[model samples]
Target: MAITSAGIGSGLDINSLVTQLVAAEAQAPTARLDRRQSDLQLRLSAYGQLKSSLSSLSSSLGNLKNFSTFRSYTATSSDSDVFTASSSGKVSKASYDVNVTALAKNHQLSTDPTLAGAQFTDVTDTLSTGTLTFKFGTTTYDSGTDVYTGFVQNPERAAATVTITDSSLEGVRNAINEADIGVTASLIFDGTNYRLSVSSDDTGADNSLEITVADDDGFTNDGSGLSLLSFNGTDNDLLQNEAGVNAGLTLNGIAITSSSNTVASAIDGVSLNLKTLGSASLNVDTDKTKVKTAITAFVASYNAFIGAVNQLTAYNPDTNTAGELNGDGVTRSITSNIQRLLSNPVGVLGSDFTILAEAGITTNPADGRLVINDTTLDKQLNDNFDKFITLFSAYGETTDIYTNFVSSTDDTTVGNYAVNITTLASRGDLVGSAAANLTITGGSNDVITLDIDGVSASVTLSAGTYTAAELVTELKTKINDNTDFSNAGISVDVTESAGVLSLVSRSYGSSSLVDITGGNGKTDLVGAAATSTAGVDVAGTIGGIAATGKGQLLTGTGVTSGLIVEITGATLGDRGSIDFKRGYAEQLGNYVDSLLASDGFFESSTSSLKGRLEDIADERTALADRLNLIETRLRSQFGALDALIAQLQNTSSFLQQQLSALPQIGGSNSR
Candidate 1:
């Protein structure tokens, strides 16, 4: 068929054509390899997507499983009859008569009376006398000798002049308030004149103020206008005269108290309904219905998980193929573990409780779907709720099935991760050493060591090695004997198990170092016999003080002082303490309850879902990067092949031209 190569002018040459075809055939295997790699990558990407989806579904199922139901009630009350209910949703017909009595109030008068129009010329002068005082509810200010300067001045006294020289009037006010006297002082501005007035810091008759004047000529006891008996009740009461005034109330059959006003107070062992009277008949079965709702929710969540797992494994007619997790080991393992966990019975009150077929949930062999028998479940919930709780919840001494389902460590493939954090560097306690030149008096005659910064001093006593308890006892004796050590606020304690000697300062607030070393020439037993060779040679000021005074005690700054640790580094890689500045954990728990009551739990769950979506977005970015790289490689390889094909075509054409131009050997013979 190719014999007409000589007739077709400038046609392709046979040999060049054959060579080009053979080169093209050799590249076919490489193309196949590229396609196979692409397929593998696609499969891996599908697997990743499936895994991510499953994880998200699992998280959602976990939340559904944790869903809970709470009961709330309203109350109604009458003056004669009090009603209480064990449960709400139904009107309690039973009623009882009740009687309430108000509590009595206690009152008292102030002891240190101040006459009206009494003025202070100088608060510091009065304070210097070592007795400037006030009273509260007949209780005299006992700390009169420790009084600082005050700022209160009588406005009624025209000739009385008060001039505060050292501190502001506010400072004086703070001092008086801190003293907790019955009278509160305030500054009054009348145009150009500034006057200070003292008022009773209490309510009712209990917090009346009486002023008496002494030595101050301008002060007067005026009985007529704004008399000395003037007792104005303002601010907090100095005397708490109201005794248990804030009592809870449960009126009629309803709780109408100032506090929780719930049905719990309406009747003994009963909660009351405090609602507007109405003819609508309340259904008592509503409470039972709520229990039914909870059961339904639990079943729904359990079934949903089962359905999801089944979808991930079983084949379907619509999809015409097995699920994403078909034949997957992880999926199978999870299913098997969950099934075993649910089926296993837990010991409780002399009986084994389980949540499998007995809970009205039966597994279908075909699709692994759980079918719920509602009738059976309702009966079980109604008859044996406590037992049901025991089976599901970790109530009493029984282990909970729910907790085990989520947190059990038996399955390692998927478990919650716990992270631990620790502070990097912390210093051990400092110790002191004994030297022959330095007199070591006070405390026991045992070897002691001291640490300054990173340096250590070891002073061995003449006695043999002693236990930590013995060392502590000896150290205490030495401390008691030496007045300087005791007065210097230094304390010594030894830990036997760790063989650690600790030196603590009594003055914890002070930032100073205690000097353990005595003077150079002191001839104590420690000073004469102590040798520096065995202990750390602290030459300069020992414990922040230079060696001074012969036979006198060496005094220095106190020891419990150092540079405060300022945390500065990379973002703290640990969860810090969440200390409530003004509240407690119980308050926080109540806050959480309030949040949950206000639908904040749903918001939090949605936020968590949004976070998961962001993770999916990150995965998509990674997939995009991989896709780009694959495309780049594929383009480069394909382009090189196209260029080779073009070159082959050109070579074939050139060979054809050369053959056409070749001399014809048998043309005449053919003619």
Candidate 2:
């Protein structure tokens, strides 16, 4: 920009010359960089398209991998008001005539029917402070001995109880609620006197209340004060409706009884919730619409994926346009692998159905997308859905195995198991002497802690004088009534003849162990034996090799892996060998999942493409920097030329002025 006249002295345009030189230098390199950047951008866009296409394909495969995708059962009830029925695809096409008999109800008892219309003077009044004993069923006690007879008792209920801190009619209800004894206590009144009422939490015949009075004030159902709340079998002081009964229903003329109105076991994979008493015909059939929808969706996804890939890889010479990823190796590999998977049959051996083509799904020869024939698919589902389910889902073959085969979902490996029962599983039990000679000085001093497996619970005995048989009966009730012990499946049994006391586990597995630790007064009843006995584990062999045992399940460990099965019945010899077969859907789903999961083939392909794009960007940046240096050098040379031309022009002017001053007639005049 500074004043310069290089052309004035040299008789040439110096600025124009420099500008032309720089333009020539930039022209080839700039074009090359532009083409390289455009290609890199196109490749990135192509990869993006590929990623989108793969995601769509993967999403479609998800439906195939689902276990319930093959379920085709539809259930309809003739009388929806009585009960609504629903079923899964596992249910066979059948019909059942269901008739509701009687619904389940909870045991409800109230104070004498005559006293229902009475009003209490004070609801918060404390009547007595004693142990509120809730004994259920007819389990007798022999006070002549020191401990319980330990014989068969009724099925244990939530017979747990709490100390009688408050004895008001309302206080009693609150205490019963806090005890959580699977029963509810409330007061119902019609304005005269408040009458106490007790109800069971669940609707079942076994759940009933038997309140016995044993307080500190020597109260033992004397019909005075808090004794009004006590009621035994012989006592008729309290009157109410009959005990609760289980719900009764007839399925296909077969009788069924359930503790709740909602019955699921009556039909496989079907739930029947009964309302009013009525008869209804339940029909179950295939849900063809849902199956068709899933199939169509998968087909669409496959088409979309293939279509996107084609757009990127296709080259059209006539149109004079090329695809973004034309001739790209990574894109070609992705397309080829997917095409190979689609073309090949899945699970080629031991299967009647092996590929999508076998299931009436075929590829279009032109576009390489999937297509389905609805009529053929409908026929297959109508014929036998189970076979269709096996065609796509992974299935296990259990020949003659016992011990209730739960399931094996951890790993997928075709396996075989040779069964062997070294010893039958057993429960842990503790037997004690008869209750004919037991002694109890203080009930509070007899606190015992019982642990089933690892679940521990504590219970304290009543603080009153008790006969030997009574004390033993109370101990049995205490142990059976504890929520933790009962939930852990620990029960009590007595033998009056042998006077044997024993503690046992309900389940026949190692996880069902039992332990009992007693303090002071409690120790004297069980012979001061505070010890633990472990439950037994099933012993078996899998695949002709010793298999590791966990409770009742036997799984392959050393020689083989991923082989698992359950054993219940303890036979001396082999139960049966299990064979697993992978169906078409199972094979395809696994393969597709491999392509979509982290570290899968598609992931590697994408990562490689992304890496290349990064390298291209770096190359572009380096070229730009080199071009910048070239431009700077050209500018510098031009700047020097301009300055030199200005200097020469100034010299020419001074020389001309000096000549004009020395010569007489050499100057020329111009207007």
Candidate 3:
């Protein structure tokens, strides 16, 4: 009988045989595909690590790429008890003798009912309902007489009004405190009755307080009801506790005054904070430690980046093994390009200092790392500090002091660019046709409205102004003090020559404009037939190419594209030339940025590897399908062979049984 199972039919193990044959057919090709996929994956990982190292190096090179990072200064004061100082930007290195004469003080006033003998009993005692208006200005007073003599309203501070919804004393105090209008109000008790004290938030001679009241009792300054709070140049219902005063100081024997204790305008790029009355010597000098530290950081980061490259492309002969990116053409090219760029010299920076090697920064031949010589570097920094900075930072040197190198973009190249100015920039001005009226009467010709730089504001000049200088000063103060003009960063310079007044906008360019719009004082202060003219922009060229001009800045085009320079001189001809140089840090930083970009070296290499890996996976799938077909065919062939053998054995058994039956007769006959 033939067996039902595959191998049992012919006494052969066909299932095991088919399995062994399929494995043999699939082994070589499948292993090959798997090895290819693994190699591609390793290469992709190496590229990622290399990208990370390059990015870290790029970030570290940011500060060193700019010249401003090396222009740091330190201001040291001999005695900090009297004053402390700090400096920034390009400041002159010099010693200054500063003497603090006095500190700034704020104005304080208190309601003294003892003069009138009308003291309240409790905090909730009702005063009167009315509006209290606060104005800021300068005031002159007679100490012996205890009376105010004159007042000049400061245009910088706007008047603030507070309403008394609650007539109680404590209620008025809370309301005044909540106004937040540059003043603080509080209730003070001097071991007796309580008094309300109000003080100015600012400390200056021009920041004195003047309180006026619109009382509900129809008397604004009669020392009755809400009128008791009135204190102005004429009325003194409140007693003055302290007068506002400016800080006084002498810088280098020159007298200086500031509204606050922190003074910033006495010296260029330096700020001084006064503490007490005394003397101190201040010295400003270049900070060298910061420059050295920046250079050291650049070296360390470059070394780390090169170390990653070395490991990624290294071959270990001891184990007969190599790295994933070993022998890669892209990797080799990157290394060679970096080395070439480092060896090249910067020519635009002049001959004395150009290359990193001149500044004691040399590369190691054995390990491909940066090595700094401490002694040599210190000598270079001490001897040629400015040249040392130009070695690793982007620097520009100009021939003319007035024509400054403002800035440049990455697209700007190294070389000299000549500057030429066709027209000088000017500011808008309004000149009066005749002399201004000296006398300014209140409610008749004291108010003036003006339009400056497209902004409009009305300023009320002080009445009773006579001298030409005083009128000019008053006009400038009132016009600059307007909130509308100050908020928009617009101002005007007022000057009077031969009794004629001129108003010029502080800003330059075609957008700068000033005009007398409307007011009763328009015809009196600056005549009705005044001339108004708008400013014109500066016109110039750089590197023989017509540049775009806006105010004082001039930008170049063509080969000198992205280069910018500022023309501060009034000359209308050839100004000078700017010698721009791209240092080592800038060149390397740009190169690294290109290599790590989206369409750059690392991205392209990793993408190709990923594609190859995907192809390997497809090859593995095809191999699996081919192996499955082969196993099916082998099982079918083995089953057929086993059946054929079983059939032959059955036939032999039948024949043997027939012969035995026939052979029994022959054996009996032969016996």
Candidate 4:
């Protein structure tokens, strides 16, 4: 058997040819295996992609399951009962009376007039009697004794606002009022010019205005004869007037006050439908419409779950192709479990209304849509609304079924459904717990009660003097010492003006109460009348001398003029103590603290769930990175196989060419 090369020689060399073909055929199995491996790799790659997507989706849904919104409603007879009681057929409504009360205190203004004795005498002065001069704030004006009959016509004199009556007495009174002087004057009209008298606008000696008369050719001056009137007692202290501010109203036993004139500003329990006379109350109603809405939501959620399941199972009737998850054990398990959840009994209020079917909801297996029997539903709502609510709400014993479904940690439980598309799209997460507390304290002779917006507490002191300064100091100290006080939201401060003392709370949202007791106790030194027996008096005198006064002595004074000493324990009147309003500030403080803790939304649970979602997102990012690495390796392997196939084809072509060129070497070439 001779061998020749011409594409490995094709004709008549039976044994040799059979050997070569047999060898080629033997290599075919390896190539076939490689092809099979490649095909499998492609399928596996697709499967891997689908699985990754599903897993990612499942993780996302898991995060959504933790969402506060999704899990906000828990199955229970309470929610269900209220809903059922208010619902009629498809609609459910309920009405509740709510009342809000204002915790603010009333403020009043008053006047106190008490002064020592002071004397004044009336002096008769006529234009012919004398020339008078008035001085005010570094400005001075002079009036001649010539009876200045036509002075009103003089532009230069007019600049001084001078006025004169026909009689000298009346002229003086007119002059006082017109001169813009800080004094009052009147004339006792006599046959002659008149007797003029003047009074200081202020009550005490410090406020007394002086008048001087100068003798002139046309006037007679009574220098020593002039005297002003006398007064005994202190000036009046003006109290604040809070009247005509606004009237507060009570709604349904709730006290509501508003700066606004409308009734809507008063209550929150009911929405006020404003009318011409008053308002109409609108309450939540449980009617057929509402019931239908709730049912619809449930159905939509269920359908979404079914759709997700179908997608995973690759149930594509259009293409007649099975899905990536076709025949998957996990998919089958999920579908079966979900069906169980829909038909399972929810133990609510010990009623037979355990499943949706019992509540007048029927499921159609053909299309998987839940249909509601309106008449039956209405009967249930009217007769046993509470039972219906319990069935839907109660998870274990009287809670919602949905709650039980998502809350089930047991993977094998009937309600233990897998993470689904809805949960992923909704971004649900679980909530966590965190809280804080606040406290406030008042000072001696001080009564401090804080009502935070609506929350109130009181701090009372025994009878004593609660000076504005001391109260301010104590408030600051307490706020600094207690973190909860700041967290709860009260701010404190002090204010002083003229001779008055005031304790102020910087925040105004909440109210607090402070009371002072035993604040009245005085040590002996100055007369017992001088000092406050209770809280420290910042303005009281010691030993008959001004307590705040220093660095001076009454040398020329009588025996009472020794070095001034503070009456250590002199008692001021019972009313001498200071009182502060603090409750409002405390309330405000607490509110601020709550706001900070609850992320300003007032829902701590929701805030906690959001935090969990953030963590899940981080996990998904890490998984994606790992999947990318796997894909890169698969791409590299496929590239190598393609290059090897190209090389094998080229070698076969070269061998064939060589065989053709070496033709007929062993067979009948001589012809």
The runs of at least 3 residues in candidate 4 whose Cα sits more than 4 Å from the true structure, single-residue gaps closed, are: 1-277, 284-295, 308-321, 348-352, 372-389, 393-484, 488-671
Candidate 4 lDDT over residue span 1-671, tens digit each: 97533233322334454445445644555455456555444444434444343343333322222211212221112232122111111222444343322222222212111111111122333333333433111111122321111111111110112324322444555665776645566554334323344543322112222233333333222212111111111111111222112234444556555422333333232223221223223354333344445555555555554555566466668878875557767446545744665565554324456567766778778756567787887787667654433344312121222111212111211121111111100111111111100122223223443332223454332222233333334334443334444666644443333313233444321132221112221111011222111121123322232323221111111212222222212233221211111111122223323333436422443344355555545645654565456445544444454455556777899999998888585678745
Question: What is the per-residue lDDT of model 2 for residues 284-370, given as tens digits with 9 covering 90 to 100?
Answer: 877766766766777787788789888988889899887888888867876787777667654444455556666678888898888
Cα lDDT tens digits, model 3, 1-671, are 94389878688888889999999998889788878878888889988988898898788888888778767877889999999989887677789999999998888888776755337667786768888888777878654577998877665555668988887779888888899888888888766667778889999878888887888778877766677677887678777888888999998999999878889888888899899999989988776777888888888988998899899989999998888779989888887888787889977435758888888999999989999998988888877887865577677778888898778788787888888899888899999988999999989999988999889889998666556866887788789978999999999998888889999999988888889989989999888799999988888888888998887788888877888887887688889898888888888888999999999988888789888888888888888899889988998899899989999989999999888777465565776
Tell me how far candidate 1 lies from the true structure as C-alpha RMSD in angstroms. 21.3
User: Looking at candidate 3, what is the lDDT of residue 64?
Assistant: 83
Model 3 ranges off by over 4 Å: 1-5, 116-121, 142-145, 348-352, 429-506, 514-532, 652-662, 669-671
Error of 4 at 340 (Å): 1.8
Please report, in order, the local distance difference test score of every candidate based on alpha carbons: 0.36, 0.65, 0.84, 0.34
lDDT of 2: 0.65
- How good is model 4 by TM-score? 0.31
- Name every residue pair that clashes in candidate 3: none
Which is better, 2 or 3, measured by lDDT? Answer: 3
lDDT tens string, model 1, 340-412?
Answer: 5555554422453344456576777776666778888777755654344334432222121111111111111
Cα miss at 649, model 4 (Å)?
A: 26
